[model samples]
Target chain A: MTRLRFAPIPAGLPATVPFTGPETLERRRGVPFVARLGANENGFGPSPKAVEAMARACAEAWKYGDPDNHDLREALAAHHRVAPENIMVGEGIDGLLGVLVRLTVAQGDVVVTSDGAYPTFNFHVAGFGGLLHKVPYRDDAEDPQALTAAARDVGARLVYLANPDNPMGSWHSGALIEAALDELSADSLLVLDEAYAEFAPDDAIPQIDPEDDRVIRFRTFSKAYGLAGARIGYAIGPAKLIAGFDRIRNHFGVNRTAQIGALAALQDNDWLEQTRRNVGAARERISAIAQDNGLTALPSATNFVTIDCGANGDFARKVLAGLSDLGIFARMPGTAPMDRCIRISCGPEAEMAAFAEALPIALAKAREV
Target chain B: MTRLRFAPIPAGLPATVPFTGPETLERRRGVPFVARLGANENGFGPSPKAVEAMARACAEAWKYGDPDNHDLREALAAHHRVAPENIMVGEGIDGLLGVLVRLTVAQGDVVVTSDGAYPTFNFHVAGFGGLLHKVPYRDDAEDPQALTAAARDVGARLVYLANPDNPMGSWHSGALIEAALDELSADSLLVLDEAYAEFAPDDAIPQIDPEDDRVIRFRTFSKAYGLAGARIGYAIGPAKLIAGFDRIRNHFGVNRTAQIGALAALQDNDWLEQTRRNVGAARERISAIAQDNGLTALPSATNFVTIDCGANGDFARKVLAGLSDLGIFARMPGTAPMDRCIRISCGPEAEMAAFAEALPIALAKAREV
Candidate 1:
């Protein structure tokens, strides 16, 4: 047998998927989930204008997308009130994160992030052989100060902090993020992942200068914009660092339909407002359901609500398994403390109703177990 | 000014785009091309069934694409008569190449390829700090023997060969490719890029063992399948190597619309057959046009035709410029010898007529220059 030669980093790594998609579970279970709330995908759907644009662009699928991503970047520049050079659009935040890690983290380089933060980001860091120094979350939020201190302590190259944190649905005020930046080492670049920013309160959205070389902010259409399947996202940062992406990125990687659809979605402010309203309503409904089932719903600044099952990680796992058995696809944090909670995405009325109906039965089964 | 920390490899590299897309040209020229023949895109377009499926999937753009690409991989496995484990779906051939390079090539790792083969592959190699040793094309064809010799000499970890070669539209028989593999070092993996396989003649189609660990074959829907804008492709290889992709790839990177569209496109064998016929006719038309313009068309087993201008690289470049000025987007090889030819993609009748009309004027302009 011919032995394949893989780089030392990849060879040492296990073939592990960062997250098992809900579809894989469906295949394993032999039944589709009644409410697709896992993966933090927006179930409210994308704008009608965006859908129309994508559907229209289907005939033009033969042409490769603009390698420069010109028009969309220009539109995004106008939307953000920054120069186009400040924005670099990519396949998604996931894709951008991989590139960012590659750009900064060489093998054995130190990096910092919250312990139970985005596994996809961690996956990229590990894939590149970066030495990860994970700081524990503070009170369910991705503590910016902790991340900064860790970066400084480790002499880290990159530090990641996701605002409106995942799995816990908690957030820090923008001022806190800015304050934390002051303590960050000059050599360490802050990777501010604001994927759920559009769904967060204004106080939770940071106002970093576009020219700030110390930081790069990642934003995506997947969350509140409801174009998750389109796979479009952008990173905002100093022009110099943004230009670095062109050095290594697959120039024509972004899908043309995604470019057209994201632009249309960005233009339809009415649709965005309506979706926000829908998400807010769904969050309330989910929280209400959680309270009725004798669980405490965390105060969420993002689209998802994390409900405390009022038990340990094992008990929460049993509850999660029960929910899966009852055809409600949900997820939880991978580590302790936070693992006591189950994360559920905000969806339409029917999905919320389905979750509402299933939660009690799942909780009852978990108690029995 | 704060100095951003980039890894040594990326920091030393200049930010260069591999290719300047035609859209960038259009924006610079302030007009869309009359004949979109550049970028080797299929002007014949995708199957109607694919367009329909994509259109239907537009509403489901809220859900993330299945990370496993389960359905598409199953269909592809059936089509190729291989197990699903042997197939690894990615964003595109370009995206897959990036991952492949990341997996195999570390900094200063030696790699080999034909000098003027796909620039995107070169870009990925350089991006990963791989030391590329270029072997000149033998008689306008990618000399597999030369590539193998160079890989053996340099102790290369990876060797790239685009079958049905790009830019020159040349090809070798499958038997020759199989025979060349015998000389390749066991340590050097052959990166067989069959992006244009659908357009190749039967003799040029290589039949390699699916479990062969010495080579990994890349295939794409962006070519004959007419889904370039969709950005979908797959790599067929030993299950071990295929599984290694899961260690580093963006699990949810492939777009949902692309998955649905490609599956539909694959099922529509009649559309593919029709497309092949269209491309063949266009090749003949393009050849006739070249003959009329006092140029010699190279024998091609691909959708595009490379027309030798019977002059040096400069003359052909001048001719390319003239064609661009005439609202015809065409391309040429970047290196010498092969650069004497101008490449044109197969398009519909109207585009053919436009190219035919513009060639004489462009030639006249080139001669004057």
Candidate 2:
């Protein structure tokens, strides 16, 4: 056998996937998913204007995108009431997280996050050889205080917190995040992921100064803007931190169509308001379905709802499997207490109807199992 | 000021750009270029089918792309007559090179490449803290033998060689590469970048077993396929080496429109054939333009022609500046010998005519300078 040399860090790391996409599952099951509600994606899709912009951008696909991402950053800055110097656009939040981890975390460096928080972030931390210090979620919500305390205790260089957190779909106010920032170690940068901030309540996102070097907030076009497939996101932070991204980022990584699509999407606030209303209705329907099936749905500020199966992790896993078997795609958290609930994403009426029809059968099957 | 902590590697690296994109130049000059012939992008654009496919994919933009890239990978595998396991898709060759460097190169590890060959490759190596050992180009083409010698001497973990070399538009036969492989150190992995392979001579690409653990081949949709803005590229290597990407890659990184567009682009062989012919004609016109200006155009196997300005590197630099002032975007290399030549990418007739009209005026300006 030829000796192939992979660096010690990657060689020791296990080949793992953070989340299996719906397409993979469909291929494995030899059937198309009746309702694609597993991944937290907007089913109403992007605005007609954004779609038209992307379609138009396709003809100009031969030209490389602007490496500086000036227009997109300027537009994003205007939307956020921040200067362009405070923003950096990248492939997506997932891609940006990887770059951020690469920028801050070194081998064996300490990093902190909620135990069952976004696994992709954890995957990035591990990929960079960061020693992860995980704190347990508090009552389904990621405890900002606990995360900050852990970061300080561990002398972590970075701490990750996702407002309107994934898996459990719970959120804390911006003031809570600011308080957590105060508690963080002086040297520890708080990575505040607000990927779902658009769908979140107004108060859920606190007004933090972009000049604060202690915190960098992430937002994506994938959620309320409804351009998940475009793979575009941006980070807002101190000018110095944003400049540092230039030293290591794939400068032309953002797709040109994505930039154009996102720009047009940002301009279409009417479409955004309509989608938010639609998602609110869909979330309520999902909650009703859970209630009818004798389960309790956690109050959500994002596009997904996590329902307590009124049992252990095993029962919840069975419920998820039952949903999968009935052609309804759903997901559960990766860790303990959180695994007691199954998560469902909001979609259009047809998809919600499919999930509603399967929920009772799935619950019955889970009880039998 | 708040204390910000970045990793030791990034902190030590300089914030330098690999290429100053045309958009950046346009913004700086306060005028758009009449002919955008820099950056080596295919100006003839992607196939209409690809454009149609991308436009169609916009409606389905709600869904995240398959994390596995299953369909695209299968299509690429079939095209290459290799198993899907042998391929790994990424944002672009530039993005993949960064990941590849992260996977194989630790701090202070030795990496070999031709000096002034591809600045982006060097940028990736420097970003990852790899110690680069650069061998100068021989006769405007990458000297594979010298690269292998340097790798053996330095005990390099990786060796990078671009087959149809960039900037100079020169190439080496596949047999020469095969011979170089024999001389490479047993433990060193060769990264053969074939970004411009489609436009090269028939003998320039050698047949190699997909299971060859000693080599990894990179191909991009950016050049001949004209999807640079889409940022899709794939690497073919042994299954083990390819699996290593899973340990650290942004799994859902590739955009959905890119996947759809590239698949359609790959299927349109007639479009590719027409493009190849167009590129050939454009190269000839570029050569004629150079000859008309009392310059020697280098024999090119790629989509661009490098014209010797009949003086030194300074003269060529002045010519490039003159072109820039005349609203014609063109590029020259960074190092000696290669720096004496200005590189111009092949484009449509209108762009070629614009360059043709501006070449003499630019040459006269350079002479006055």
Candidate 3:
């Protein structure tokens, strides 16, 4: 018998991490990456204003962050043109998702997600002892209508859909997502994770009433805004559900430096636009490179490109391993059909050049496998 | 009827917050205090090296921090003379508390704490639908003997005790705590929150087998190292229990700047020692100030001193508000007998001088009240 025991959920929880970070992979390999393009982190960097703000705040690191997050909330409210009550800032969308899961899910409670959706969300559901039922994606695209039906079928407490979804860099427009929201079953709360929302086209986000309670939208500065390291994000929903987060959240989970950096970042619209433009250019470059290598790249509205590897799961795994051998850090989809694709993040020109140079050798090695 | 509603447990949760930060209180009072000596935050500041590290790290703010916190965990492991598996870094003790509560506490599970202990712990229990019971502090300190009995009586899922306790600043020697550990009931998991352990005497920390799993200890850089703004702290326990955090924790919850800043802070032993000395000296100054006003200051081993106003709760509140009015931010305990004391954090010479200059006026105002 194990001398020490954990509570049931944690006891049954396999010690499997949601994702093995590239740094861990590097440590195991004993070599750092030549081109770090995985995880969809913005390589364009944060606004100088944000950097300066953090630098200035560093001297005052002895003080805890303002627990209320008043300044940042007010600033986010002003920037998003929404009331401060409509926004709940947190450690990141990852942190916000955990709280949402706790609020809605109980032991054996039903939850729904796309089979190949964000693994972190699945981790939360399983961690909470929620019975997770996954609907398969239709052609690497999240079938929202099917997801809604599954929620009704299972009588799920929550349904999650990530727009411009990760791993595949696929998307459906705001109009379709709004239609999906309308189709959601009454008993099910919709968690529309828009972590990559800022990178999508202007019309991609639905113009919903801020007071609507059926869905809570998760947004983060981690993607196109290039503040991933800051660990700051916000959720927008009706005050009733939003207030529930305050009941369970780590009040000071968001660092004081993050609060200061995010506030500064939200103010620098010029830098955001420039970064978005850079992402667009990099996507085009990556797409062209994929085409030259005889791989089909998915049209993306995200900060990364997911290229179809033109083979089965094993073949794609070989390609991924080969890339790792070439000192290029990239990732692939966890589930098949989607597994026949490899994802690459936008990076600086130097890193992009490294990717272009490394692809042919990596592909040849995959063929040998 | 509400179209969207949370589970009954979540809906039942209060909108109550933990501690109201000084910033919030400042905003409420329509002015910022010149001397912020509230919340027990270290005012001596983080190590200069940490600030320099943060400034250098600013350019890469766009990249996501290592989700595994690899380098940081390695450094901390070396510092504590333990394996990396023994430590689980988090946003702070607050974040870890939330996770631990979720892992062990289910609806109606019994959780025990001191009557006037950290309110945040009570808040988490309530959020998780746990039954919360409190034991009164015996003779102005947390009585481990009572705590053990309460845990056994309630069959508590968890029992918490903070060494060099917050709000009170009293401590028990490690020998006493170690003795208490043996008497602790097996049903309840013992949580020794050592947030202020650095301020305690050398013998105050019990050295147990690092491989032991029945108890967990949490430590933070927020106190003596003065890096509260970085939001970094850790829980050390058995490998199995420590690894359990991955199943429930937000893998990327900790911020990048925090990792960089805290790593540098940990290496600066000189700064840590100097800050401890500064906090000690300032504690003496604060005690002297309290005695000057004809009140008794409780003996403290932490960064803050709790002064008995020697009057009723009403008198203490009046004095706290008066201090606020005089641009000095200080707090008082929430309960009646403890409310007879007002808490003040040790700070820079300027802030301490401000407290000394303002105490008499505040006391006079309190007397009139």
Candidate 4:
């Protein structure tokens, strides 16, 4: 029998997990976390309208959803004031990113991203055999200028930047991103990930010409809209580029319930505002706690806050372990100085109270370590 | 701005839509299908437990689903009586195929499948730049011997076959498949898709050795289980191949609602049995309707029946259009011989009566054409 051999490209990559899901840890430890902040999930929960829509759709679960995603795409287009052809709703931003990479990238094509940017994007680039050139983060935020420069240097076809980014919960303002756009070579496409955009300040979102084929923007209902479990997100770009998704994407990838839930979530802007307020208050409380423990909290735009322990990455790791031992699940960045900050998602009072109860002990334990 | 260059591989394929969904046609025609017998969807709906679970889980949709899919995988592992390490769940069979092809097929690699097999799988193979080698169906059923010989001759990395197949609604029994397996090389992975396994006769399903790495089997909730909209499907194989998914799969691809929905669907065997009964009745009625219309119905082990229109592909296309005109949506195979048959899904009285009403008109229309 001939032995199966993986392609040379796939063989080059190590059998490494893209991200460790919190559920895996819970199963291994035989205990669920009392407060789950590790994955940057919005513990605030989805809107009542979204919930109602999903619950109501339950009875008709047998029917396959409209693969064209007419309702959701139409709603999204209206929301963004763009034509329906310029929008493509997918399983999630992650799923959409995979497809976008597939369309443009071929073997050994150059792609640029922040050094510790969203690992999933890197995973997709590598999955398609793209050669990734990473620029280092500046002050825990993605340096858009550097990303653009790297793209030019590598003659990269795509450049990715997650505004109000994950892991560190830091953001680059809309103006900064818009300014950086001019630096990108026309051949180097810009992918502005606005997954956390709904939580950003009003001025933090960049205004791009929807017809501009050189740049594409990604948004999600995962954070402020609170429908991550529904697996719904979308990308906005030039009609031609957006339509390219039809060539290879799983047309029926986004579930019907998810589409309904996300549309309802988007319609209830009041709920989004409330979640933002609640998340802001929680972030403040988290910052105060960090300050009390002699640490510094990074300025944040997303639902999660990253706290600097005023020490090395190892010390922050100890503190994170201490919090985990106390049943508060939080995470930290993977690379360099940014790793010194521990990330905590904003949830309700119960999670806030859990953090308050655990932090002092974690700080003390970290001192002992 | 410089125009984005699509990869050479994608350029080879047309901007073709493999499935023209009922919704698209409805919107284009400005009316809905009174009976949707097309696409082979299980019209019986999902289990009561699954609906209730999803309903109850509505609010918790804020949280991202566990990327590792711990709970569902554990449940699936226990159900299959295999180690959890052997199971890997993705968005659906479509997503899994995308990942599998990425792993095995580099540019110009050979892939083998039936001429009129699942178009989506062929789409994925083409998307990944694999050179597809097609073997035509023999006797209205998947020709296992031809597939086996072709895989070995072509040194194909993958060969796809759906037992109780799609479009033509045909099947080769479990013993025949097992016999065919003995002739395959290790390099050629037999992709045994059991998406409609639950609907198949008990004797039609072969007992598989999960430890045998030569084959990867896929199971889904989209058919008899009635959770197609949930976008959850799993593959079972050797741990080594299972672990390979970790290298590139979007970790959080499967949503929480999907996991919950599928889990609840799997737990309720009563609902599955009920759906099977209903589906069986529907299939018989559809077959009877075909015979009444002067057509010969092919044998089926699925939740759909393929009716021979007793003429050429053109006649079948006219019949299909006639059904569409009558607001009864149905489809037919694309290739020759098979295209002579019009396909109708198993559904309740409402849809079946519509088919019955529309069949005579469609036949007359075909004669006129």
Clashes per model (N, Cα, C within 3 A) = 0, 1, 0, 0
For model 3, the chain A TM-score is 0.98
What's each prediction's TM-score?
0.99, 0.99, 0.98, 0.98
Poorest 10 consecutive residues by lDDT, candidate 4 chain B: B1-10
* Model 2 clashing residue pairs (backbone): A174-A206
The lDDT values for all models are 0.92, 0.91, 0.86, 0.87
How far residue B248's Cα lies from its native spot in candidate 4, in Å, is 1.3
Candidate 3: tens digits of C-alpha lDDT, residues A1-369:
232565678888888878878888889899898888988989888899988998898898888888778998888778778898888998889888988888778789899999989999999999878999999999888888999999989998899999888878888888988898898877888899998888888777887776877788999989877888888999988877777788778887778888888888889999989998999999999999999999999988799999998999898889888889989999989998899999999988888898988888889999986
Docking class of 4: medium
The digit string of per-residue lDDT tens for model 3 on B102-146 reads: 777767888889989888878888887889999999877888889
Off by over 4 Å in 4: A1-3, B1-3
| Residues A250-368, model 4: lDDT tens digits | 88788888888888898998998899899999999999888887788988898888998888889989999999888899888888888888999998989988998999999899999
Question: By the TM-score metric, which is better: model 2 or model 4?
Answer: 2
Candidate 1 similarity to native, TM-score: 0.99
lDDT of 2 by residue, A104-215 (tens): 8889998999999999999999999999999999999999989988887988888999998998899999888888888888879999999999889999998899998789
Docking class of 2: medium
**Best-performing candidate as measured by DockQ:** 1
Candidate 2 lDDT at A122 equals 92
Order the candidate numbers by DockQ, best to worst.
1, 2, 4, 3
Label model 1 with its docking quality class.
medium
Best-performing candidate as measured by lDDT: 1
